[model samples]
Target: MILIRGKWRTASVGFLCTLLLLVFLATPVWSLVSRSGDQIIIGANEVIADDLYVAGRTITINGTVNGDLVAVGRLITINGTVQGDLLAAAQAVVVNGTINDDLRVVSQVTQLGSNARVGDDAVAAGMSFESLAESTVAGDLAFTGWQALLAGNVGRNVTGSMAALELRSNVGGNVNVITGAEGDAPEAYPPFFPQPPVPIPQLRAGLTVADSVQISGNLTYRSPGVATISQQAQIAGGVLREELPEDETAAPAPVTTIAQQLQYFIALVLVGWLLFKFVPNWIQSLAAIASSKPLPSLGWGIVTFLAVGIIAIAIAFVTFVLTALSAITLPVLIFPVLGLGTLANLTLIFGFLLFVMFVPQIVVSLLGGRWLIHKLQPSTSSNRFVSLAIGLLIFVLLTAIPVLGGLLHLITIFLGLGALWIWIRNNRDRAPTEPQLAAV
Candidate 1:
């Protein structure tokens, strides 16, 4: 087993190296520097000469950014101007400033206040979107959300996928909406009326648009049912409402019950069993590190994780310049830069993947298995498969807890990543040295 594991590890490393070399030869790199910390804020008086990338718990940008702005946080508020594009992801986002170029955002809730203006396209995805009356977009506006309320003006086009929509403003161009089926008109009218008011259209399982809206260009909508065009509504062009295809209608979401949880536990056990079979020593080492020096391991893990990202960004930026130069003049020089950039990028990305996905699984399994063994018998020597199964079951159950579960999940990820890093460093230190050739 030891020999087999060594051979596999060697082969995997070689394959990774070869793969990175190939990527370096084929792909082009771009320049970027990523900055991350907790509660990062750029004051109004501050200015960024080049592109700015930031990740934090709360990000507030009240300064002028000469280049593009990229940010991720729990809460993000941009009150200053961006000379270039802006990309943001957060739990809640409020943009009250101007974006010289495009604006892209993903969040639970997004608001574009009256002071907000986009020089180019505005694209957003969130649970809810609110566009204040004073807000304006110079180019196209596209959004996907559960509810979209646009009380502002769009210069080019307005496109959205929503469950509920309210447009109390003007769309300079076309209006395209995919939503539920609901209308204001009743089924019948009283005899006092000249004629029965048209019954508002209703969809089987679809989307609806409110009756009060003003659009300059054509109106296009697709839903299971059609929309009722209010005579009061002003559409400069024509209206096109298409029935949603039967096959294209969304299906109901599946419910996760106790049975589902049990299945998840079983799946995790199988994966853990495989890990134990192939890399038992590595798993044992990580478990030991996590149990003994948790704090130091966590500190090192955080450092490694952040340092790798910063290094990768630097490498990629340099590689881009070198590659561009090679593309323009000396093509031969591109290879070295490409190879180095590929290695850096892959390391950063793969490390993130481990922290988020693999490390948690491995660490949780190891801890659980060890605990289960201790419980069943005072002996640490027990059936590995049975211990793993018990541990995974307990882990799954704990994860189902409401608030505590989330906190536990985070702790597990941190511990797992830390332990994994320590184990890797230890292995590197213990690697066998190659003998030097005798002097000629």
Candidate 2:
């Protein structure tokens, strides 16, 4: 009995060491580490893969990158391509890129070109976006600045969280704004209308414009400031912002920002060294299951998603091919197939999201037994199906709304990917015991 007890105790220590190593190794690879760029003056034809994180004086981006960017400078210029998220904390941030993610900036002034294309959301927290007709933001547009003059298209929703927010673009989605201290009849900002630009003070945010400020939606400003109507900022949705004081000073520098607080966020480790103390076997079993059936669930999700996307693309391609094949003969079926395919794509998206939300839990529960799910929440895992059901129910509830739901899903994807990666290392310390192997 003493020998058996000693063997089990040794196994427990090894298991804990393995878990600690896993948590440590996984932390660094997945983390979005901040790395400062060396050059100050970025040229026009350069493309970058990693995110440009800078805390220097003046930085200009005239290149393309596949990651997010965070820069703090006096004059920031972006005239190339950024395929991911962008967060600029500076006096000025200029854009002429094909941005594929969200953009958030805290600057005195912001500018966009007529040819700019932002694939996701755009939020300017400091000054304004005053441009001519060449820039494009493909998602929701939110600005909290002294004065905003937008003259392009925001593909989705729009919001103005500022002293004075103005929009003059076509919206592909709804617009929402939370205004500060407007007049007596605090009307909600207008939506889907073309409101002519009004005259306000030349609130210098020190930015440029690409499109004419075509105010399609209603423009809501505070009751007392004189607005300047340089050009018609036509918008397809409403614009709402705070009522600016007639007398304005330089907006105080971003006092508390995300960049400043990220260190504490990334460094504060939650997984202690003793992660395998209570559920050592669960970890061992998870490792085993992960190593074997690791890719099936993840691959299934990705393949399903991509297959659906490809089908949609094929349908569009077929439509064009038919149109080219015979403009007269193909007209009969092109529109019908195109419409049906588009609808099917939409339905598939919702279905895919639902599947991704719950499939991993179900897969793990089935393969690892009630033991694994029970490890995370023992009290509720009496029935394995019940555990899966409850988890899916919560996911469904959270994913029904747009903003909150989308965020929840994105975080879930990250966690799932992390877990799958961890599963790959399951057998590192699990060499067979002599007694167990002999019995097998």
Candidate 3:
């Protein structure tokens, strides 16, 4: 019996070690070519059989990728072929190649060169997007951006929300657009648009349909002003102009004023300063834990938020039932039941408010500050106050932006809450021993 037990123990230990090894080395079992550098180029003669993942300042693919191609960089250019989906995020993305599957890109400027062809749908979002005359999309085209110039061939529908739109394309299906208000168009073309790395045509800030356009289906647009449609433009299903909804037609509320922003910034700084002063070590540890495993922290953060909300609702329902039962059958138990219910509900409310008001901003700011400091001055010892100040300022400025600010705020909330949960869980796991505090 002893001999058999020893053999089993050995096998279990070996298996555990193998599992740990695989976990630590996170490379996928499938074929993948992942690389990051200042610049990444796949030469014309090169062909990758596996999925390609690349991150760099500049990424140019002149060869072929049989599997999906995912790229992140400042500038991305695809001059070859991607047999699978092409997903890219960059400052500028210019595609002059062929994508056998879908093409999804988010960038400051997304341009489909004259020769560019997408076998499937094309979805894009950014400051500006243009599909040159000879470009072709075998499926639908969807875009959301400041400006869009489509002169391509779309097999299906063309749909988007844009400040300005110019369609000189041949659409096999419908064309639908929601454009900017009538008087919102600037006096000059590209008035607010940033200069792209690659040159693109200047477009006026309203919908324009040129004579070259041919639509097999209806041309429907919703705008405060009428669209500019050339007399010769062909629309098989005719044109329809939809009225703006009442809510949309109404004037928008003013964004936060300068005074309001200043007050918010001051309040945040004060709160952050007090927290750092009282619990420096705790703050540092939380930041460190979150930074150590960012992706996991984000995932856990989302899960925790959902769980907390669900649990809160359940508690509320149970409390209501218990209180009603006590009131009807046992008057004496009513006080106790009501008291407990009120206490639990109050605790949950306060905790949620605290997290929403401060935790996310503080955590995200601290992390950002730490990164910036480390990058700028690697040799200097990190000071929590300094980091918090720097990060808070940056956060305030960024969050002040319209659309982008809202997104950043949401992300920070999740990431911050996730870090806090992770730190608390870690402390609980080490309840028997003194928790080790790591410096930020």
Best by TM-score: 3
- For lDDT, candidate 1 versus 2, the one ahead is 1
Off by over 4 Å in 1: 1-34, 183-212, 245-247, 250-440
lDDT of model 2 at position 431: 47
Whole-model alpha-carbon lDDT for candidate 1: 0.64
Instruction: Output the TM-score of candidate 1.
Output: 0.48
Candidate 3 has an lDDT of: 0.74
Name the candidate, 1 or 2, with the larger TM-score value.
Answer: 1
Q: Per-residue CA lDDT of candidate 2, range 1-440, in tens? A: 00111232234334333322232122223433233333475566665657555545567677676677756566677777777777666656777666787676655567777777788777664434565466788766766545666667776655554444444566565544433332222122223223222222243232221245444455443323434434444544444444444344223223333233333222211111122345334433443443344345345435545666797778667656765555566567766766676677677677656544443333332223333233334344344334333333333432332233344444344334434344434346564421110000
For each candidate, what is the lDDT? 0.64, 0.48, 0.74
Residue 1, model 1: Cα distance from true site in angstroms: 47
Model 3, 48-130: lDDT tens digits are 99988787899999999999887878899999999998877787999999999888776778999999999988877666799
**Residue pairs with backbone atoms closer than 3 Å in model 1 (clashes):** 179-207, 180-206, 180-207, 180-208, 181-206, 181-207, 181-208
Better of 1 and 3 by lDDT: 3
Top-lDDT structure, candidate number: 3
TM-scores, one per candidate = 0.48, 0.39, 0.63
lDDT, candidate 1, 166-276, per-residue tens: 676778888877765554322221233222111211222233334556788988877666665566778899888877653443321113334577787776776666777
All candidates in order of TM-score, best leading: 3, 1, 2
